[model samples]
Target: MKNTICPKCGNETQELYDGRCKDCFFENFKLAELPLVLHAKICATCGARFNKNKWANTGSIEDIVFNTIEDALFIHDRAEDIEIYFEPRQLSPHMYRVKVEINASVMGMPLHQKLKTEVRITREACDACSRISGGYFEAIIQIRATNRQPSPEEIQKCMRITNEVLERMHKKGDRFAFISNSAEDKDGLDIYVGSTNASRHICKEIESYLGGSFSESPTLFGRKEGKDVYRNTFSMRLPEFSAGDIIELRDRVIEVRKFGKNVTGTDLLNGSRFLAPPDEVKGATLIAKRSTAANAVLVAIENNELMVLDPDTFETVTIKKPVLLSAKAGDEIAVVKTSHGLIALPEEVSRKNNL
Candidate 1:
């Protein structure tokens, strides 16, 4: 029988069961899983998840339960060891569904992507097995993202920036947070921040100087600032001045009652030298997120293994090895997600089969 290719996009696809491609099925059922947010069903036969939101096909799922709750075994620094409980995707023994449960899985994200995860099937504690006295069941071995798979050193630059920003907030009592993974309301922002109105003016000034963005998140993001309170003050009048009571601004001497900043260039009783031209600031950068879904920046990082996208063209790429990267700005790399922060790459990702 001819294998089924993705009829929709004409790509070779995975077969979980029956004979439909996962990616094609997902395209047909957009927004299928609202709560889970899975793009596709990894294994459709029995609701088992092979990978996190592979957005593949139903039967194509290899049978993995993501965020499958189980009793914790032991706690390590960044990961935990646990004995998991799960069932197979294929109902009967004649058919089998490859199911796996990983440890230290929070929500659906595997902790750090470098822990040991083994897949085993303990059929049951049925009467026949109970009498066997601690009988051993069949166990299948599985692999993690980094298992004898040589991976590049995990870069923590984003973490460093996040922590640094948090430090700045703490000192000034400001509010901020990493952009939520599923925040669709915020079309152009990667991070949300809240600050005093006074601080906002300062923040905006800093943004103009440093270059980047600072936009308001949606109402769901919570109050941006505390309520403003007005302080009562008694208005005061200045005492009368005598003739030639000197008033000075840089190189100009003006009458006390003359136009206060109402003075423009020629209106300047003050000379041009009285004002130094706008400060020749160092070069600044402007980072504006693309507002639409169609246009995307295919930026590749130069000199470094990172890439940044316009969020519209964000397609996560996971490779067996760290991809080659150019660390120079505008150098060009495949825009991809690596279980890391949004960054650009040094080179466009070649097909795994092609590589």
Candidate 2:
């Protein structure tokens, strides 16, 4: 090893960095640099931060302040084994004083630098929040039922599904996944959504949970930035019958257990499992619900027949017994009265009564 003389300071040293001794090189070298003041844009309603020319849901106000400071911090390229720490003091709700400490080594020499900056938070509406507040919507979902009005329970379930899907989409970086408005009409429920893609997802989830199908149609709403803008309307039709509904089709009486693309139920006439497509049961009249059945007195039982006293009229009537019937003589049994005659319900219906 040979000793070298620094040209700038005239000092003797074993090594020279950038034509200067270690002491002279370090005298003017800047280990770290940061602006005295920084600004952070945040949404007043959703608490989202604006950074890198975009808005994001980046945690709390303190985290946003720290991130803003870190993005603006500049460290020397020659520094190695660097470590940084931040100490923040909240001066007010919209202002913060942060002190940054940097520790590193340059040319095998330990170096430390402390910098201070003030972060001013400007609260305003982001793009998504602005659009939401302006009642902007890209799609509308109409929840309806086939051959009947949507029940309150069904409507509520649909709304729940919509919210869940929108929330998931938002977390996945879809800022426009939000509900703008919702209205209840005599026909059904109408939900206005911000994103058409999110609306499609909501409809699909609703159909999976409930039994139904949906169709989408786009209407030219206006022009934006020299481009045509179209808004979509999703029409969802729920299944005609829900669970526990007793329907009569042609010559068969069926108790619906589930209804989707395919209808599943137990035939009340013979207690056999019934499965058919929606079109097969078209015009099936909803005769009654298992919940509305009345208790009748069981008098006797013959081969494949049950003798029961009618609930309305105390006349002993003999009806064809269902295979699932488990009632004994002198006991009460569930029976539904129709235009045909008094009919004994299956054991599943009786168990529902206890529940």
Candidate 3:
């Protein structure tokens, strides 16, 4: 093999690769090749990179660019092994200088190659960010009470639910799930959402967590893609009465236990439980909170009623004893006075030294 001749260039060489001399082999075989300058599309708002004609949101810009270069490499068949390394240097906010080193083995010979190239990142807004910046929204949520203004605490709960839903949806790759705007008006609180599906999801969460019902109303806004586009407005009405509210209905004093499809409460007059729809509880008047009740002395007990002396007025009045309370005469207990009559409420008592 010391006297081999190459037929293509008539060159003499001891070693040959694919019938090519060492000089020819070196010229023909290439470990990898890339352009001097490459362009990358990037989102100005989200920092997303477009690679291989697709937008990727998973990695950093450097990782994305390195991967793109690795995929664009052309490896020759004669190269038995190939390794690539990148030394990236920032040239500007939108430009970078990447030093690429290619190490390979061809014909059992080691080879090293180096190239310095430029990566230009062109900034453009992504679809989600663009829509967000443009104030694009699909539905509006109106948080209101059935017959009165919503409390601040209720409004805060609604906002928290919306934020939580948006965060969960964003984690699942729905970037368009977000709240665009929020406003508090005299009537109620209004929240604008980016996606209709997200809007519906938020309403469901509100109902499930805060106890409410909502209705949807659609209005024709404009035309899109040669079709009429409509925007939805969800009117969510929360129950007027909340838990811990003492209400008077049908000559009965009841303490609201829970608010759901059916409003549940315990009858403060007789310790009986009652369940009614939200509409039926709407007519019930709020008398006082159980927390506002004062301690009264049980004067006497008779067949289904008891005499209690009001601690505030020091006036003796006969009220029905709640079946759940088993206090005897001369015992101190909590009692509330309502429009219909005075009622004994269930209280938690801890005796110390029989005081």
Candidate 4:
């Protein structure tokens, strides 16, 4: 290396940084700089932080303070291999004092700097929170049954699905994913949602878990910024029959196991697997529930036929044995009486009764 003279310091050195020797160059060098005071906007309800003109989910208050300090910190242009650390202390619920340490190298020489700043939190309602509190909704989901009222259990499950979907959407950065209101009517449940997209997701989730279909329609609600604003209404129809329902369809008594996109069940008369589309059993009549079945006295097992005392008449009657029948002679078994005749319930139903 060749020696050179610094112009500003008039010193002989091996290198000159911006026409200055190392000693003269470092005299006014600053590794980092930070403002004395910083402000961070946080949502009071959800604890989200406002950053870069948008609301974002953040960590705890201390993490937010540390992030704010890091964002406002400025490092020297010549710095290399920079490392930064923050030590934050909460002065109060709305204020924090932070100490920042910066270590870097410039021109093969190590440098260190320490800075301090105060983070003052400003709490306010974010856009989502404000809209939710104001009862602003873009969609209404009406949960109804095809031919009956929605049971309390079904309604509760639907609401649970709606909330779960909205929560997932909100975590995925959809700020409008929120429920504004919900109500129960004689027919079913009515849910008001802030995001139409979230409403569609909720309806899809509900249909996937429970059996049914949904349709959507839009109506003009108002105008915004010279554009027509519309609100969506989703009509969700639940399946006509639910699990454990014993329905007589086309002369076959079926016990519904699941009713999703397709109806799945076991034929109560023969204990054979029965699967069909939702539209296939449209006119099925619900005779009774598996829970409502009566126990009959088993008289004898004659080959493929079972002789059991009628639950209603106490008269011995011969009926075809179900494929899943496990009861021996003289043991009580579950039997459901339909207009067709006495139908022996499956072994699973019998076990449920024992439980």
- How much lDDT does each candidate structure score? 0.28, 0.90, 0.80, 0.90
Looking at candidate 3, what is the lDDT of residue 235? Answer: 92
Tens-place lDDT per residue, model 1, 1-355, is 4555765566775552224465454334311111211122222232323334232212322332223222122333333344343444544433333233334533233432222232332222322123223332111111111112211211122223434554565345332221112111211112222223322443343233222234432222222367443321111111121111223334333222211112111101312212222221112111211111122243443342333444554563222222343234443333322223333322223323210
Give the candidates in order of TM-score, highest first: 4, 2, 3, 1
Residue 314's C-alpha lDDT in candidate 2?
95
Can you tell me which runs of candidate 1 are displaced by over 4 Å? 1-163, 172-186, 197-355
Q: Which stretches of candidate 2 lie over 4 Å from their true place?
A: 1-25, 300-304, 323-332, 338-340, 349-355
lDDT of 3 by residue, 233-331 (tens): 999988878777788887778888767778877877667787888778768888777666778999999998889898888889888767778889999
Question: Highest TM-score among the candidates is held by which one?
Answer: 4
Measured on C-alpha atoms, candidate 1 has an lDDT of: 0.28
Candidate 3, after superposition: displacement of residue 205 in Å? 1.0
> What's the lDDT for candidate 4?
0.90
Each candidate's TM vs. the true structure?
0.15, 0.87, 0.70, 0.89
- Per-model RMSD to reference: 32.1, 3.4, 6.9, 3.2
Candidate 1, poorest ten consecutive residues by summed lDDT: 138-147
Clashes of each: 33, 0, 0, 0
Better of 3 and 4 by lDDT: 4
- The stretch of ten residues in a row with the least summed lDDT in candidate 3 is 346-355
Candidate 2 weakest ten by summed lDDT = 346-355
Q: Candidate 4: misplaced stretches above 4 Å?
A: 1-24, 349-355
